[model samples]
Target: MKQHLFHGYMTKNVQKRISEATTAILPSEREMNSGINKARRAMTPTIPTTQLFDIAEPFTKTLHDDDFLIVDKMITRRQRILLFASREQLKMLLGVDTILMDGTFSTCPSVFDQVYTIHAVKYDQSFPCVFGLLPNRLKTTYHFMFQELKSVAMQMQ
Candidate 1:
């Protein structure tokens, strides 16, 4: 058996794999609740020798869930802090009562990595908190993810 390494870039194949994996996990498109483990498929086989901390667009899966939820992406240190900062600001403005807690999480189980820049949000009066960790590595991908998230959050607001 050979273990495939993951890459930072999000390519066409990556999307396909992510969709496949997600569908395999949630075949009925049922509501994904807390403590629900998703899928983990290698998007990139090999990391670039020289690369920036930018992850390709379209992300891996669709983020159509707006219910009380927490999402943790495997990002890096820079991304952790920056993303936290951005979300924190937005939460304050939106009066969402969001918190940037310290913890570790992953989309895939058996991975001991913990995400630092964790965000907790409960939009409606439904769930208590929307909690999740960021990506694992503190590589450039983290920075890029944070920047992109911050940018998007800014534009959305």
Candidate 2:
């Protein structure tokens, strides 16, 4: 597409050939994305902030009564609570020796930062045992999460 008075013009064929012959790859180069957007589009339309909290109300209701579920707002930003683990999920996590942790930002909505998952091997297979939405990737935030989970695990034993 570059044009100069002395060089004239570059045709479509020339551009195509140039792109095809190039071997240099950028650091951020990624494969063409296709199916990734479909699931996001299929989801229910984005809910309002109030509704988002309302959706989580039932889960928070258990925080006071349930000894297993750990929900703490001070651990993260913007009142975005750090949900450590549910009773059943904690039980599963306690039973597993090898644990895996991963963070996914692509599927996370604008309401939160990233979906942090803690997985464990059970019955010779890996399963996502607990999920949490972190507001920021701070060392303190992660420490709080692991510390809470460790305390809960100790209580279970």
Worst 10 residues of 2 by lDDT: 26-35
Q: Which candidate comes out best when scored by lDDT?
A: 2
How well is each residue in 17-46 modelled by candidate 2, as lDDT tens digits?
Answer: 665435344122233223445665666444
Clashes in predicted model 1: 12
Candidate 1 lDDT, 1-157, residue by residue in tens: 2223233243345557776766566634244422243332244433423222343433322354232222334343332322323334346534555555455564422333454544445654332122333435555655655565556566666
TM-score of each: 0.28, 0.55
In every candidate, how many clashes are there? Answer: 12, 0
Which stretches in model 2 have alpha-carbon errors above 4 Å? 1-69, 76-79
RMSD of each: 15.3, 14.2
